[model samples]
Target: AGVSQEFDLSQCVREPIHLLGGVQSYGALVAARRGDAVVDTVSRNAAGVLGRAARDLLGRPVTELIGQEQWDRARESAEAVDVDVDAGADPAATDSGAVARQDGPASSGVLPMTLEGVDGPRLFDVTVHRTGDLLVLEFEPRAEGGPFVFQNFYPRVRRALQKLQGASDVTECCAAAVREIRALTGYDRVVAYRFDGRDGPGQVIAEDRSEGREPWLDLWFPATDIPPQARRLYARNWIRVIGDVDDRTAGLVPERRADTGEPLDLSASVLRTVSGYHLEYLRNIGVASSMSVSLLHEGELWGLIACHGDEPRRLSPEVRAACEFFGIALSLQLAAVAGREEADELARSRRSLASVLARLTSGASDDWMRPGSGLVELLDADGAVLLRGTETVEAGAPLPEALPGLLANLARRGAVGEVWSSDRLPEVLGLEPEEAEAQGVPAGLLLLPFNRDGDLLAWWRHERPAPREWAADPSRPVRTGPGGERLTPRGSAAVYRATVRGRSAAWSPAQRVVAAELWREVSGLLTRQVVALEARNT
Candidate 1:
């Protein structure tokens, strides 16, 4: 019996396979037989340039496809030779200087040749070599004018989307998006901006800057920077791609036949260009090009995805399309997060109200008043003195010596449910004058209203540490030796100004959205807690 044969994929191909090879460099597979046929020819970007599927090249013949000129050159070359084929040149129109002379061996280095594909006759770099019995011709794709021939978008895009999906919150989502954008385009800075309120109070909430370079980190800009008109336009149009910021903004000449007579909304999209003001703004910040993706929720502009590069940049059309799709996915996540925050705020408010009611009915106890009480801690303040009838509370150092008689005079006048500080003795008490002692009041009276039974009720006060300007700026520079000294005010701009002067602020719409969401959630919680407590008591 004949030995059984098994198909071995590696054995079938002349060249070793590299399945996990990085696509950063260009490569091709070429196989062809002498005279009769070309066995197989394949390249990475077959569909993009050749306009044919690589699978079609399998088992194909050379004479049946490539023109006479390429076949003739392949036959003559004794060893591998690089041949330049220009499809743009007329085949019949040969140059008399070279082809006209019928140069010896056709100048082995770069013989002119042409190829024929399904789309029609094409051109390529054909390397011819003699393999004893059958002549082999290797074909490499010719570079084209569009996107760089070597870019492998599939894996890059997949990785980007995977990263975006892993983000948990809006901040992380925007941050992830910025990081991906930087990786995709090699830009220097990326930012996220969101509207603060419906009235256009937006700000930057996140930024991803190049390492070791001083980026405008944690800086804030006024809403006027994006103007009402810009905000309204962004709300309507979900995204805008600015190919070249410094490029002229003239509309595509003759108008887009598909969009003719529509009075194009320039703000919506300037296609291939950007507005002068926007360009100048980007330039001021040292960015030469930018692309922004609008994040929207409930028909409102939630924020923006900004990609900024130091030099003029033009992203591949495919990349732009991919980014747009990714932006839409991000918008959905933003909406979901916003909805969750709203629900959380409502729940927090209800809880706070319940707590307030419980405290007001039985009177607030020492347990709640002990934390962060400012100077009130020194007075050994009791619960009644902290929560007594009052809209707010204030406390500071002990009162002056004459204040005891003054407080007595005011209390005798029936100043209902009010507390006042005093340091003087009251003679009407019928005791020898000593300190105007009142509950561990700490050399001062802990004022609280006496209930109907003249028992201590509630008091209110708030005191905090003295403000300091030494560490104010988040970007502030510090000089340290044996004794450290602050170099500037604690301001992001001041810190930036000290380092890099007059640079445009680097912020964006996505950051604002994430921050707005955060601020809204925090403020909503505080409001709910306070309102809930008030609601219960009232």
Candidate 2:
């Protein structure tokens, strides 16, 4: 793995510049300071040219080399003055003829300097700019080849692949991917944002944050934030790379086509400008630059891998290509892993249900059918009741007289019971005729009835979801003052969305499918468990 290291550029401005299509080692060096202090004097090729021998230049004040003549000239100018130098020349030779670039007015001061290297010669163009208590020196190199374009990310990519292979579970795999992306890109924060819509909103379900940062771990935003239209557009566009969120928008170049009148295909156009809405979102999130890759599962939108940077960053074409490849591989692995886990759970549930049923089909009495509680346990339900409506008998005298009728009606309809207060249920037990209509209790309570050889051996009843106020204002009401100053709790829809309905949970397609499948499986399992238990009793 490649580790990123930062050095104090207070020394100098040095960077590697290589040719695009050619092989060449080119670098630049510059020296600068603040208030007569020798802050930075370094070169990228220092080791190659000066090496340890280059130490001679350190701690030397700029006024020394110029003597009186050039010093006066520099003190008057207060601006950068490029001077040609030959390292081979004698120090005492006036022919050494160096021009001093001053950053102040005459008589103010001058930074006198010379550059020497062990190598035959190196050409540098330096400019000096002064800020409050700080001097900046920029070095521009004149070289045969262009500056170096960083490439060869194979090592980082290889390590990421290895980690992916070693991941034990889905969360770990995603976390590994996020970590690798962040590490590979040198981004401030990289997150694996899975799209979850359960509560009418899309949100981040999982994230692995970098150290020393606030967590966007489980944060959710409204679907309107990334509208369906926007998502569709993003899918068509493939990906987006924002260089600087605060930067001015560049003009969108009208793409030319072979036929003059033919409209350009924005789908494949990388130059299509980003929308203002998206830019605002990025700014709100504190991301200066970002790269988002769409994750697809089963040919549908799965989620995205969002790489965020605290500072503006631009990825080279090669780096972008590498990221795409890595993202695709990760998405495939994630989907496959999730599928396998789901299959395993289903298989386990089926096995448990089969065992429970084996005992019931033997004509076992209700007491022997007790172990069928295993069915409820496997189903993850609060409780399970086997109601043989045709043969049900009330054992407790205090029980409602109409209890059997209510249970029988519920059995007629297929419903999975959820939690609900007694008040929410209709008075199907016929406590009061008028009250039953008003309460609208058991139109038919949720029931899970399984058949045993054409006989209704037992049925399961589940409560309904508890009623809760969707949203409540948090502010306290206050009376108006003399100047009409007042405060009051105005109900907020946003709060309701976040708290009551749990928008994300309510809108999740994946969760819904999972719930439906679980219900169907439990129904079949209950039949088997009850029959098996009855057989054991016999």
Give the Å error, residue 379, model 2: 1.6
Mark the regions of model 1 whose C-alpha exceeds 4 Å error after superposition. Answer: 1-155, 199-201, 251-263, 266-273, 354-538
Give me the displacement of residue 286 in model 1, in angstroms: 1.9
Instruction: Note the clash tally of each candidate.
Output: 28, 56
Error of 1 at 145 (Å): 8.9
Q: What TM-score goes with each of the models?
A: 0.40, 0.47
Candidate closest to the true structure, highest TM-score: 2
Candidate 2 per-residue lDDT, tens place, 1-538, comes to 1123322321111111010011011222223344564424433333443232224444555444223453334433334432211121222422111111223321111232334445544443333434223333323243333222234677777789888878767778878888887777778877666664311334454565557766665555443344443444343323556667775532211212223332222222222335554565567556788888766665455677887888887654345546766876786788878777767777676676666555544553453236443544444433334455355422212223344455555445433432111222344354443454444332222233443221222222223332222212222122234544222221123233223210111112232233344445445665677798899999
What is each predicted model's overall lDDT from 0 to 1?
A: 0.44, 0.44
Put down candidate 1 lDDT per residue, 236-283, tens digits, no spaces.
444555555565432221122122242211221213233344555566
